[model samples]
Target: MKIAFVGKGGSGKTTLAALFARHMVETGRPVLAIDADINQHLAAALGAPAEEATLPPLGEHLPAIKEYLRGDNPRIASAAEMVKTTPPGRGSRLLRVVEENPVYAACVRPVGGVRLAATGAFTEADLGVACYHSKVGAVELLLNHLVDGPGEYVVVDMTAGADSFASGLFTRFDRTVLVCEPTLRSVGVYRQYASYARDYGVALSVVGNKVEDAADVDFLREHVGADLLTWVSRSAYVRRAERGTVGPLAELEPANRAVLARLAEAVDTTAQDWDRFTRYAHEFHRRNAAAWANERAGTDLTRQIDPDFVLGPSALSAPVAG
Candidate 1:
């Protein structure tokens, strides 16, 4: 299962993502956490030291990643021609939830009990030359090609706000945990996200964060309604962890911990929709291709989509055309 935590900036999405990843790992499930947020703080949140937190950003090696994923598929002539929206075909390399491929070997690092991968930080050089979308494109491409299965989990801490809608990245997850605080601005972000998500058939659950009293919960309910899956109360343990004094998962406040379990259960029980997943990959690739990627590549990028292909666990063992 792929779960993404997104919300307004400072709404505690990163903290929730870290906690959920830790919770799943502790419960004996295979979990991988990818920090696709521009801030690149997930490593520290997951208890990695300052030095270890500097992960090999996936953006730095987009060309190499494209090369590996293209994998002798006749439709894609070269990595340079592959855009972030490129969908995997019969001959393309498909990734497992946990694997030893070069992409993971170089980019994935262990932080406590959770496996971590970062989209890299927005650096000084990128200030004027590039958009953060280019960096985040690495994650979009990764999701475009990978195939996950039952008992496996991928937790992504996404960029805040409706910026995710700028690419097809928002549709990549099995479930999205929108960490909303009981504030007008927070609920405003939820409204924007929900409007866009509803069109794509996104399975979203609103997790209210930092609730103080019954009033806060009521506020969330009044705004988000039935989409409100659960809420986390204020916690001294979380505050301590935020301040750098990290503690074990077992040390979390019982109420907050239960919230994490509930969040995990909500994601764990959602059925995988590989058909919808593959359809979006093709849909977005066609859109990107027609809009810009095709002109950039000097060929119709739609050719890259294998009409007979469906990405899933079974696709992993299916025969390749090449």
Candidate 2:
């Protein structure tokens, strides 16, 4: 299962993502937690020391990543020709959810028993010349080629707000857990996200955070209606964790901990639609190719799509050669 946590800035999406990942890991599920957020605090939230958390930034190694994934695919002439939206073709490399591949070796790190990867932080040089989506594109590329199975999870902490709509990455997940506080601004972000996502068949579950009383719960019900899946009350355990005094998942409030399990259940029941996944991959690749990547690569990038290829566990067993 692939899940994304997104919400307004300071709305605890990252914290919730970390907690959910830890919960999955503790339950013996193979999990990969990715920090696609520009702020990049998931490593710390996942209980990694500041120094050790500084894993290789996926964006900084795009060339090498593209090269490795392309494998011996004849369609892709060179790594330079691959865009973030490039779909995998016959002979292209495909990845299991948790694998011992070069990409994982270079970009993944272990934090408190959970595997973690980060989209390199935006630095001073990226100030005026680059979009953060370029950094997140590395993640998009990986998900495009990844084939995950039941009980295996990829939990991503996405960039805050509706900014994810800027790229096809928004549609890359099986579920989007939107963290909403009991506030007007937070609900506004939810509405904006829902409006955009509704058109694209995105399955969204609203998670209410910082709920203090009945009024807060009522407010979420009033705004989000049936989409509100669960809520977390104000948590002292989470507060301590946020303050750098990290504790084991057992120390978390029972209600909040149950909320995490509920999240896992929700994701587990949501079936993967490989046909839709492959279709969207091609759809967005065509859009990007027409919009900019074509001119940038000096080729019609739509040809990168492998028409007979499908994304799922079966793709691993199928012959990748034409």
Candidate 3:
């Protein structure tokens, strides 16, 4: 399953994403945790030593990545020519998660039991002209080519806020867990995310974070309603883990464990419709290209979606314009 955690900044999505990856590892599942956030702190949250957590961001090494994944393919000459919606073709490469692939070796590193990959941070040199979207594009290309089996898991900690809507990344996941706080601002983010995600048939569940009491839980239930999957109470242990004062988050509070277990069950049982997924992905790419990328880059990226690509149900069948 490919799962992503998204929410407003400081909403604890990164922490929760790391914890869920750890939980899966503890349950004997092979997991790959990708720090797709621009802030890129998931490694520390997962209890890796400061040095170990600082793996090369796969985004910064696109040239090498292209060389590795392209293998014998003579068509894809450079990474710069790659587009977000580019699917694997006859000569293109395919990556198998949790397996010994050259692309995986070039991009991922082991942190405890979970393999970790980061999208590298946006630096001062990037300044005004270099958009963070470039890094996200790299991740999109990687995921576009990745193939995972039933027992393998890929968890991504997405960039904060509605910026994810700027690309087709949201449509790439099997499930998206939104970490929402009790505040109205957080709920507002949920509204924005749901408005866009619902169009894509993407499964969404909200994990109410920092809940203080029944009232807080009630508020989320009332506001998010059926989308509210579970709630995690405020924990001093989580605070300590955040501050690096505690060890790895190997253990969860009983209540927290229960909520996470339920989430795991949902993720495990849900069926992924690949035919529908491919169609949604193409539709989103088309919309994003027309709405933004064409103007921004002065080139039409929508054309990258090959005509031969399989078409399933269109995510745009709904009236929502994401």
Candidate 4:
């Protein structure tokens, strides 16, 4: 199953993303958790250390390419080189290289023995591009890498806010679960986001994050409608983590675990549908699994959705413009 969390900032989005990753791992799925946000805080919230990489943000290349394409003085390299360096393809170039102390090796830390790979920090270019424009575009490319990578599940803790989530990357995943607090602002954000998701290709859902009361959950439900799927109660652990407390959440805070389990169920449920990226993934899995079913049936084929049929009911809703 592949999913992403998107909503406005200060709505506990990073925390929601971390918990979702942890929950997937705990449930025995090999998960690829990505910090697609350029702010690069998801890893830290997930208790993974942030490392500094020298590569540029993928977004930076676009504008640089734009500038260079327009004959402006630009540092962007050739498209072939860009494709060669990062390669754009998920498993190509730097992403697929094997190494001792591989960044993602630790990024995918074990929690009760579940494997997870995540980006602990942004590359130099990633940071610059994030600061410039197209932070969402950079994230989309990064997710393309992870979707190309091997994993049963992919969970994205999107950077703080709705715009980034609404960008193309959100549509790339099978499910987009908006995490929001219960304040009036959050409710408004949830409504706006749910409406947007309906228009985009994302299967929009709402999780009442930091739920503290029945009324709060109901309040979210009133606005989110069918988009509202789960509710996560408030937890001291969330508070502790907010202060920089660290490590895998093997202890499984009750509030945290409850919502995570719901998210897990949501992820599992969404895996069965047709979506934009699902078809390509399905084809990849079909061939790979076909090869393995003969000799490697035990191989994992979870992220394998077919993007060939990214049409019909599964397509994300489009935005209703003025």
lDDT of 2 by residue, 75-160 (tens): 89999999898998778889888778888898898987889999988889999998989789999999999988988999999999
Better of 2 and 4 by lDDT: 2
Clashes of each: 0, 0, 0, 26
Q: For model 3, where is the 10-residue window of minimal lDDT?
A: 313-322
TM-score for each of the candidates: 0.98, 0.98, 0.88, 0.63
Task: Show model 4 residue runs off by greater than 4 Å.
Answer: 49-78, 81-136, 145-151, 247-250, 272-275, 278-322
Q: After superposition, how far is residue 184 of candidate 2 from its true place, in Å?
A: 0.3
- 232-272, model 1: which lDDT tens digit per residue? 99999889989987799899999999998998889878999
Name the lDDT value of residue 196 in candidate 3.
88
- Candidate lDDT scores, in order, read 0.91, 0.92, 0.78, 0.53
Regions of candidate 1 where Cα sits further than 4 Å from its true position: 320-322
lDDT of 3 by residue, 45-120 (tens): 8888787778787877777776555544333444455556555443455566666765577778887678999888
Output the better candidate (2/4) by TM-score. 2
Tell me model 4's lDDT, rounded to 2 decimals.
0.53
lDDT of 1 at 66: 89
Q: Rate residue 219 of model 2 by lDDT.
A: 100
